[model samples]
Target: MKELKHLNKYFKKYWFKLLIGVLITIIARIFSLIMPSYVNKSIQAVEEFMADTISLSEAKGMLLQYILVIVGAALLSALFTFLMRQTIINVSRYIEYDLKNEVFDHYQLLSLNFYKKNRIGDLMNRISEDINQVRMYAGPAIMYGIQTLTLFVCLVPLMFIKAPTLAAYTLLPLPILSVLIYQISKVIHKRSTKVQEFLSTLSTFTQESFSGISVIKAYGIEPRINAELRVLANQGKDTSMSLAKVNAWFFPLMILLIGISNIFVVYIGGRQYINGDIESIGVIAEFILYVNMLTWPVAIVGWLTSIIQTAEASQKRINEFLKAEPSIKNEVLQPTVIHGDIEFKNVTFTYEDTDITALKDISFKVKAGQTVAILGKTGSGKSTILDLVARLYDVTSGEVLIDGVPVQKLNLNSLRNSIGAVPQDAFLFSDTIENNIRFGNENASHDEIVAVAKKAVVHKNIEGFAKKYDTILGERGITLSGGQKQRVSIARALLKNPQIYLFDDCLSAVDTETEEEILNNLKKVSESKTTLIVSHRVSSAKNADKIIVLDNGKIIQEGSHQELNAVDGYYKELYLNQLSGKE
Candidate 1:
């Protein structure tokens, strides 16, 4: 229940409608109560007229009045019921809309690490299933629960006023029934939580299998994957069946108790009639009507219990996501603009759960508009450096500064927007090629995009397509070849025209001839921009103003190509290896 406190804002917004709904429901219940009394009074009127207790004309008038009262009550009851439904339905919709929008806004505020840890399916469940469950509580469950309570409380007093003994007999089983409902509700809450968890697992499996269908097919393991899916499906089915079994037993037990109470009422009321304590058959008939009305309210207890428990479970899951704090957060007061000059001063970093440092007390500086090349083997922290510079993750020790100001003192959005990055595995959305390029600069003109594409050496390949720039790329750019995708990604980064450009092995997919052409273009474009290129190939790094060699997360050598070739170290070994392979 504490977890659901966040929903109070939505409740406050729709409280007027909710109040109207409850008021209409109460009016409807009161009008409905009048019908049984009118029926009883009309019966008594006829009996008295037959016994010569009233004049014939007077009896006729009395019967006519009772009939009109009954009809009017029925009409009022119908009208109030309609009003109740209309108001509550609107409240439910508004609350659902508000909750969903809040969830979406929260998602936007979350850091990248949150997405990396949580699955897309689980997040979808929070926005969809969890929100719908809350709607159930706001809509039918809330309206019905309030109506039932009012009906019981209002009618019970009326019963006592009409005939105290009959009222006592009818309500005899209520306390015991209430205790039973409370106990069953606890069990339902626990079981329903388990059911929701199983459903989340099933959704996760389905989303993963569908998203990775290409990988599954390429591995030729569809049968194995199908078997795993079957297992998850069976688990979900078993959980649902178990919940059904609980519901099956719960409802019948409640009905049985209500039935026993009804039997007791008939037995006790019949004896009172025989003893001449009760007046006419009309009073006993009205008592039966009241008992029938009481049955419906008791029946809804089981349903309301289920709705409340499911709402609580959903609230808990949603709150867990909302409470998660990002590892990299903006400082209390951060700078807005960052100069291109960057210095890494003995920075050391390791991941949260690992002892092995990814970057070991490294130190380097790149002047504003200089091109620096990082030559390293795999797992040599090339990507980690880019991640740190972008502030995707903070350093464990030392400092990384931009324009002599610590990066931690800079605003995250302003800093990140000033740099362009092309990672190792470049990804493009399933959208038009023009749109993909425009992701780098949303307001970039068509001419600018074309210019950058030509510089990346992919414009000719794109023009070969039927739709050219308008052609829709497949998911992750599956429609394009590896080299084409790499070039398109490079063009997107170039469109941004940022102060810094970070290329992490972006040319690995293109052939040496194409790579050389792209490098020549980059040399001209990178003249006044700070550029850092991470490459495994010796040919790519040979022409840089400075080359830094890294191995096992440490810089082993640094100098010009000619200066490094003069030394007998890792750089010379790498150069000799490349020459030998080419021969």
Candidate 2:
């Protein structure tokens, strides 16, 4: 409900239209009520004239007036219907725009941990399906509810005027109907909530399966994946059927109550006509018209109840997401420009739901414009250091500082924009090469992009493609080879020309010759910027200003490659192995 209050802005924008629509609807209902009275008066006039109790000329005049009234009421109804539809539909569109913008903004502000915890498909469902449910209630349900209330107010007065006794009898079943609607609505709300949850689970499963289809096929586990998918599909179907069942029972029960009310109107009004207590056939006929008007309003009670319940469930989910607090938030003050000097001081970090520390009591410093190589065995927290430096996650204890300012105090955008990273598994969108490069520098010139691609040694390979820079890569760059994709990613990062660069095994996919070319390019680029390279190859770390060896989340040795090779330790052992392999 608190999340729904955010819609007040849209409400303010459309308030006048809604007011006009409601006013018109009330006027229309009032005019419609007059038609029944006219029918009764016209019939009584004709009968009196035929019985010679009134003159024919007077009856003719009365008939003309009644005909005009009926035509005017029909016109009013049509006009109000148009106005209500136009206003409510536009309101729905405005609310949709607001909800989408809010969701997108929230996504951007959320921490990396949030993304790690929630699946992409689940987020999509919140933005699409859940938002649509809210729109349905806001627009059509609210509009119809207003229409019903107007009809009830206008028709009840007329009913009392025509035959107060019959009107009183007709209302007897309404309280029972109200209780039934309330109970059914509660059930619908509970079931609809479950349905939305199941839909999210189904969407998550579908997205995961499709994204990992390559792995599934490679491992020959398609049958296992399919079975898992079937389970999720059945769960979704069960929840949907449960909701449909609630509607099925609720609608019929509503109709039965309405039918009984209609029958009572006919039975009691007929006796009044026979006993002469009611004046004429016209009176009974008008009473029936009023009763017919009551029918839709009664039916609408069920529809409105269901709509509100569904909307409430959707709002609850949306509210939970909106209320989620990001683990990382911006600093109160903007930080000064960074000079790329980074230090890790007695830092310790452990991921959520884990006991082992990823990095413990780690201390290191890299000066500006120096190349540092982090040599480590797998799972030695090399990549975790880069992630921490980028503030993807906060340290569990101690501090990481950038240019003398604590990383937490620095402006997040300024901190991240100052660093460029090429990860182990490089990813690209299904877009042109030019567009992908432009992601690093949106306004980069074609020549500038080509220059950076040359530095990454990828330009020649790109030129071999039919469309070259304009070629659209397949989804996740699947159309390109692993080395080509990695080089493209490198080219993109190089284009940024950041103060600090991180290469996390980015050259692993390239051949020895291509890897040497990229390393040569990096050697030239590293002269005026801070660079950190995480690699397993001894040859790659040989030229670094400083090389640090890590094992089991702790640094085992730190020195130049020649100095580490001088010692009979892990570095020397690695060098011997590589040299022996070459021999």
Question: For this target, which candidate reaches the highest lDDT against the unseen true structure?
Answer: 1
Per-residue lDDT tens digits for candidate 2, residues 1-583, read 5556756777787788767767766766676677778888888988899899878788898889888888887788777677768877677777888888888899888887788788998898999999999898778887878878988877787678768898888766766776787788778888888988888888888888888888989999999998988887788788889888987877677778777777787888788889887888787677767766777777678668777778777877777788888888888466558788989899888887455678878898989898999988998888888889889889999899988779989998888888889989999999999888878899899999999999999999999999999999988888889999899999999899899999998988987788888899988977889888988887788899999888888888999987999989999999999889867
Worst 10 residues of 1 by lDDT: 330-339
CA lDDT of 108 in candidate 2? 88
Model 1 clashing residue pairs (backbone):
none
TM-score of 1: 0.88
Clashes (N, CA, C under 3 Å) per candidate:
0, 0
Model 1: runs farther than 4 Å from truth?
A: 42-79, 82-86, 101-120, 264-267, 270-280, 332-335, 445-448, 460-475, 579-583
In candidate 2, position 444 carries an lDDT of: 92
Put down candidate 1 lDDT per residue, 459-572, tens digits, no spaces. 999999999999999878989998999999999999999999999899999988899999999989989988889999888888888898888889989888999999999888
Model 2, residue 290: distance off in Å is 2.7
TM-score, per-candidate, Cα-based: 0.88, 0.91
Candidate 1 has an lDDT of: 0.86
